[model samples]
Target chain A: MQIYLPIAEMSVSVLLILGMGMAVGFVSGLFGIGGGFLMTPLLIFLGIPPAVAVATQSAQIVASSTTSALAAWRRRALDVKLAGVLLIGGLMGTALGVWFFAAARRAGQLELVIVISYVTLFSVIGGLMLKESIKEFWSTRKGAVRPPRRGGQHPAYMRLPLRVRFYRSKIYVSALPVLGLSLSIGFAGAVLGIGGGFILVPALLYLFRVPTAVVVGTSQFQILWTTLAALVLHAVANQAVDAVLALLLIIGGVFGAQFGARAGRNLRADLFRLLLALLILAVGVRFAVELVVRPTEPFSLVVSEMRE
Target chain B: MRFGLALLLCLLAAGPAGAETLVASLSTSQVRITSNYTGSQIVVFGAIERDAQTVARAGPYQVVVTVRGPRQAVTVREKSRTGPVWINGPQQKFVQIPAYLGVFASAPIADIATPGQRGRLRIGLQASVNAPDITMDRGTEDDRFREALARLKIKELLFIEDERGTTFLTPSLFRTPVPLPVTAPPGDYEVDVTLFADGVLLARAGTSFEVIKTGFEQRLAEFSTEWAALYGLGTAAVALLFGWLATVIFRRD
Candidate 1:
């Protein structure tokens, strides 16, 4: 059935929107990430206005990440203290990001900025994940069980003031890097309409050497809060969130996440990492291609602020 | 579109003294956009009135009806290759242009009136979009931008022209359906009807209709802007509730 979206000022097929949410949610569940990066582009490809697409998907991310975060909490995989620290900066960054988003829209550069950031972010994070996962996959195939290493010397950059021991991740690092990392990622996430979990998971894994299992849970917890903040900010600042669209997507997402989580449990660890890494790279390449390629219709439209 | 309202006939104009005058009205004064509103069509119905001393001297009369939605500010941007990426290039900002425009005619527009005459009356699609204040840099490049804007609007069905859209039921009565596309902005829509005979402008009549959201849709739009903080929280709450419910039903841990 076709339903009108009030904020978007468009009519879209309910089934089509539901299907998009289901597919994106399945990825979110399987990877334990919010999958906002995937869903935002898909929404725009389906012809929802970019402002509405970005704002509405922020709300959808809250729904998907909440499921992943709760599941991780139940499994005792999530670190609540770490999430609390991350959120302190994440919320601050999200507020700044929303203001930047409004400024970019007024300048008619929002889409260009979004595409460029997507290509740059995914290429870096996806490349890193692919390299690490490939190394682990081949080592395991050679029947070499990974050996436990002695506690390593702290990375030089991490030795800063205000040290804290994150009991869950079993790491002692300066809180500055943690706050800075999340704050930067939060700003990037809010602008790009993503949960930033794809970047967060690998950053935790590589920089702080967070345990892989804990990384997914902790990142999901962080995504849940940041995206909730983004949703609220976009709604209040831009007034562009489509309530109808968000509701439809959430309904489908809840069902898809259940099936994906079940499927994820059966996958081998090394193989799961390899698959997710490749998927992230593919989406990054898609955005890169869109940038350089000559568009079929080069003209676009925008409604400026109301003229009194 | 309905006609035969002889009692409501008011003389709008006459080509000469005491000649035939045009009288017109619309099917509805307001179009309510409900949840299921895909699009709508408004019928413009009219009649020809003549006094006791008047005479029908010329060929068959022609009717041209134009419906223009509320004036809106818009910017049209064109993308061009810049380095390895394509970015918005030259842009044109229109301070006031019809968000929705549709034109209906009893005959082919070209046959009804000459291009110059049509342009003067601002009767056709080309004339409707042309406003001197809209284009500041009047060059071929700016022309391309304006044409591109029209093309884009036409592609979206926001600009429409249907020759033979209006039909005459009798010698004095006529009606036409002016389609308002799904994307039509909600506001006042001006409907102008013109009469032509032998390529000469004869009579003119103007009416208007309003496009408005129904109570439910109106409230939703207003609440999003007025109570934005609450609206934002409510959407988030719904998401959180759904998330919690999913875990209850599907949790494996």
Candidate 2:
């Protein structure tokens, strides 16, 4: 069935949109990722306007992240104190991100900026993940487990001020780096229409040396807030969010997430990481190709209200 | 027999002296874009009244109907390779361009009228709308952008021309269907029907129809424009509520 999206001023197949949401949600569930980066581009490819696609996916992220955050909280895995600090920076970062988004849209540069950022972000993150996961996979083949080290904290972080103690993660460090990291991530997430979990997870685990379990839970908790902030910002600032599109995606996402979470339990961690890393790298490369490649139709149209 | 003569006499009396009389009506006066609206078609039907002397002097008649949507500002951008990546290059900002334009004629437009006549009457798609104002440096490059804009709009089906789109039911009666695509913007649309014979405009009539958003669609558009902040906050709140509800219902022990 075709449904008219009022905000986007377009008609799209309900089944197609549902399928996209379900597929993205399934991947998100299996990987414990927000899936906004995947969903936004897919929506654009399916004919949703780029701005609307980017903004509307933020709402979907809020729902998905909230579900996972609540689950983590119930399991006593979430670091609430850490999430609180992250959100303080997150809100401030979202404000800056939204401003930049609105300005870029007016300048007719939003789409280009989004593509470039995605290309750069996905390549770097995917490359590192692929490298780390492959190392682990090969080590396992030798039938020996390596002793884990819990000492990856950067010495440079000690000089920062506003020291805070996080009981859940058992870390005593300056809040500055945490705030700065989340602020930058939040700004990038809002602009890219993601929860910043992909970046946040690695940053927390590798840079702060936070335990994997706490990192996962805290990342989800913080994503819930940042994506919510982005959703509200895009709506109010750009009026880009489509309620109908968001609703359709949520319906499919909820069901798909259940199946994905179930299937994820049977998958080996090393295999999952390898697959995710490849997927991320693939998306990044696609964007890079789009940038350098000559387009079939070089001209694009932008319709605006007549300003007399 | 007496009534027939009276009708003929009335027709002659109603038509302007030594000229044809054209009367037109649209199938609908308003197009409502509801939540389920995908696209719509409007039929324009009309009758031409002419005296025997005029009919004998002129050849078979041709009817041209045009439907023009509301005017709006637009920006068209062309991309070119800059360094390793392609980016926007020359840009044109048009003050006003019709969101939709459809031209339908009984026969091939070229056969119906001369190029001069076509330009004067703005008959075909190319001549119907004037080139929009360009903001950047005015030169031949701006004209290229203008043509590119028209081409892009044509590709989108927002601007169209169908030479044989109109059909004649009788020598004096004609009708045509003007299709409005799903992307057609909602606003006032003007429909013009012109009758021509021997490369001369015999008569013309004009009417308009409105395309409007209705029901929930209307309310949503209005709210988004009027109360953006509230709408945005509401969207976030509702999304959160939905997420919370899903968590409550779907949570496993």
Error of 2 at A260 (Å): 3.9
For residues A1-308, write the lDDT of model 1, one tens digit per residue.
88878777767889998998899888888877888778887888777888899889877778877887788788888889988888888877777888999999999888788878889888877888899998998898899989875675778867899998898899988999999988887788778767778877768878998876677778878888777877898899999988989999998897777677667767777777788889889988887887898999898988775532
Q: Could you give the CAPRI-style class of model 2?
A: medium
For this target, which candidate reaches the highest lDDT against the unseen true structure? 1
TM match of model 1 to true structure: 0.90
The collision pairs in model 2 are none
What is the per-residue lDDT of model 1 for residues B1-253, given as tens digits with 9 covering 90 to 100? 1222321232222235326578999999999988777888889999987777866656888889998888878888888887899878778887777888888999999999888667667788877667566655566676777788789889889988889889999977999988887788788999989888777666778999998888778899999999999999999999999988989988554
Ten contiguous residues with the weakest lDDT in model 1 chain A: A299-308
Cα misplacement distance, residue A119 of candidate 2 (Å): 2.2
